[model samples]
Target: MKTIIKYMLLCLLAVNTVTAQQNSQSINLSNAEVTPYEIELTQNKTTHILFPSSIEYVDLGSSEIIANKVEATSNVLRLKTVKEDISPTNFTVITNDGKYFSFNVSYKGQPIQLSYDLTKFEKQKSKKQSEVLFKDLGSISPSLVDLLMKAIIKKNKKELNIKSKTYGVEAWLKSIYIQDGKLYFHISISNKSNLPYEVDYISFKIKDRRTTKRTTIQEVSLKPIRSYITSQKINSHSKQDTVFMLDQFTLSDKQVLSIEVNEKTGVRSQVLKLRSSEILKLRRVELLKL
Candidate 1:
């Protein structure tokens, strides 16, 4: 009887050794390193997680569902999963990440959970600033010819001249210079009207007439000038204006550039054309060199 008992004990030890080896192999297979952002699906549900580098999916069958829910608390991302429901045939869980995971109601008995890591698909940082670039045209100024193109469709030259002579708009060449290895511009506008008016839109157009090709860097939209009366007794006129600033530009020699501003629904606009020499002159003036 003692011999039989000893034999039974030896048999149990052998069984335990085999079970331990199988468990170790299973762990090594499931935890293989995978590429970032790559996904692995098992049983039509995301049972194992892997990145782009992962070679295979690890399956955790229904019996192992209880132990399948795991959390990753790495600095890259914090993840959590919980079992929502469990049945004899299947199991379900919900995962929380940047967004909540969705669940289906149709699979009431065989619900599946999904989770993902986004660190692999993160966008790289950009060095460029958010800006718009206009074309490069040599020194150009607002000409009466260009202004006529922006005039109200039906307004005649007589009416326009009368308006300009009576309530003429003030004009000025603000300045031009270079900054951050690029050119910069600032243009200001003022409203000298007695009545309040609304400006709908503004546009800038550049006409490049240069012997060499020039690269235009940036353009800015200016707000329309609006003004209204503050009081009746004073009967004082109020004025409002807009200012535009351009940056990062390179101009070629002998370029003639035209910058035009137009107001939407208003029969008026301001245009500026400057040549390379004129731009240099303005820069010098700004620097107080001449």
Candidate 2:
């Protein structure tokens, strides 16, 4: 009887092992295979690939092909062939948005296409899956941050009445959102007159809210890690919305946040102030809902 019991246990274990092996082969293993994009390069000409987000890491399968990020652009990768008609090799690229791309490289005297945009081909993960971050972005994924900004722009809800208007131009504070350990501010600029309103700059600063004017003012400037602006100039009778991402910060009761926008070569400067109470009224972003 003891021998029969042992034999039965062995049989069950064998069956389970066989099932697990089949499941892995049919599902996970098969899904792990990714098709590589095919491209050809030449010795003289260079190929440029534009990504939707910033490029983080790149790996060359062979030394025959050299890749570099284009100057003044974070997401553009320039590829060139080291030897004429070199053997077929491959390369890999990782974007800041947590997307992986593979390419099969070959040599061509004159490739059909020299420029490629991989924006639409990128696969966006769920909010939970998109928690990956880069060094510049801190704790939040840059791609996720961009998505949140798009959602806020789509909603287009004016959450606060903070704004500045002059010379038939206005800048409105639309909404404030917080996620991970960062803050997002949505702003809108409108040109209501017939002339275009060219923007010189927009700045955010924390200043002392003193009762009397002091000879030496205390102010701390805050810079956004990422900013999206539609246009530098607001066309007549049109509005442009922008979003800025900053590191999370808090202020004392005696300090206030100031946002200023200036016109290029013009005197249409506007300033909007927010107290600690107003800054604390930020809404937490729900990435799933977005």
Q: Pick the TM-score winner.
A: 2
* Candidate of highest lDDT: 2
Which RMSD does model 1 reach against the true structure? 21.9
Q: On residues 153-211, what C-alpha lDDT tens digit does candidate 1 reach at each position?
A: 11211111101112333323454444233343444344565644344433444444643
Tens digit per residue, CA lDDT, model 2, 1-290: 99999999999999999999998887555655556789989999989999866788899999988999999988999999888989999998877667677889989998999999776555443212222457867766666777888888888877788988998988898888888788889899888989988989889999998856645778999998788776788889999999888889998999999999988998887898988888987888884267
The reply for model 1, stretches above 4 Å from the true place, is 1-167, 208-243, 250-254, 282-290
**Candidate 2, which segments miss by more than 4 Å at Cα?**
1-30, 72-74, 120-132, 135-143, 211-215, 287-289
lDDT of each: 0.35, 0.84
lDDT of 2: 0.84
| lDDT, candidate 1, at 178 | 40
